[model samples]
Target chain A: MPISLPDLENAIRTAIPVAHLEIEDQSNGCGENYAIVVVSDAFEGKTTLARHRFINEVLKNEIAEMHAFSQKTFTPKQYEAHLQKST
Target chain B: MFRAAFRSSILSTRPSALLTSSPSSFSKSLLIARRNLTQEAKEKILDAVNATPVVLFMKGTPDQPQCGFSRAAIQILDMQGVPPEKLKTFNVLEDPELRSSIKEFSDWPTIPQLYVNGEFVGGCDILLGMHQSGELESLLEKNGVLPPIEGEATKSSS
Candidate 1:
């Protein structure tokens, strides 16, 4: 019942208009654990907790099956700032 | 071995103590036939959350965290200057009931869940985000859970 990377990406895209998305498989080859960064306009005006809750709701089934899941979410504006700050 | 000891400890405690701790409205829904998590377990978790001002339901003790995320959480709290006396950690791995019940209780799927003043804060990712943003410092300060700044008090007195 391990979720494929494309399937997870598609699930997020279909649910929300993703501006940017990065998913890293942290569980070696088992595909259970994931570290993801998601950027979307949908996250605007929402607290970090609320954004995570929204993503959790979208991937509820996938998350339940996976062993561990970690995510960082941001609005487009924040993502832009984050990118500039990193570089 | 350890499981048996944990089980015996639960059995030794008065059943009334288990029943008396109020279960929140959210936990009542978990009572329905969906999962194996029990009402007694939820009540225990509720009590654990309120046991201290800063409660961390993690995979292991703060001194020796088993998971990377749990360790990172402990580090963040330490970096925030949260007093050890004000913090309490529950190793969910030690208790099967708590391991499952806490997820249902907080509506969060991950471990290393944090509670400030009995409110569900978030998991490691959220905590790390807050830590980097400087919001966690203010939040801890506002809640009065963090230790007082060293020089500020002395400076004001002088």
Candidate 2:
């Protein structure tokens, strides 16, 4: 019953109905804990912390159950930068 | 004995007066002192987390919480059967640098952070949802922790 990586993903997916989303479990400290690169127009007007907060709000329950989530809530442009950096 | 006492007094007073006497040194030294405190706080948090099996970096202590989220987290733990002895919490509201640095350290930009077995766990809402679904019980079981109650766990903090 412990929160799993997929459960965290499902929470974010449900919280932000964005165009794209990727959840990574970065518990290993090798960028393997948990990273969610979310693409949402909802991030347009929000500051970095605000965007993070939005994700936090969405995953409030999951956060309490799971551990170590590093989120990059992004607009389309920011998501694009993220894609480029990863590639 | 008089000379020893005088030297000790001078040593303590000398450092205390520098900041009060000079405005520039005051600000600069204050900045340095703040930085040292920040470093020390981070170390303390890490050590505490590493030492304790279950730890929470929360907005207030378990007995008296300051924020709704923190209060909710404590409630969830109580409902989920997490005993008082197994839990250790740090009040983030008391330390600004710790509040900010914890975000950076965990890359988890919120309070009420939970750690199980020296690993980072998510914040409040996540904990509640897990509790509801019974996932919390299993996690505690895996860690050799016993759950508090089976039914009648329907109490909310606020």
Per-residue C-alpha lDDT of model 1 across residues B1-158, encoded as one tens digit per residue: 89755642343312221222132312322232224567788778778888899999899899999999999999999988888889999999998778888888887888989999889999999999888877787678778897556765212332
Interface RMSD, all candidates in order, equals 12.8, 17.9
Q: Write one digit per residue (lDDT tens) for candidate 2, span B44-127.
A: 777888887788888878889987678988888887767778888888889787787776566565677888887666666557
Q: Largest DockQ belongs to which candidate?
A: 1
Consecutive 10-residue window with the lowest summed lDDT within model 1 chain B: B13-22
Best by TM-score: 1
Best by lDDT: 1
Measured against the native two-chain assembly using Cα atoms, what DockQ does each of the candidate structures obtain, in the order listed? 0.17, 0.02
True contacts kept of 1: 0.28
- Please give the lDDT score at residue A68 for candidate 2: 50
State the TM-score for model 2.
0.47
lDDT of each: 0.78, 0.64
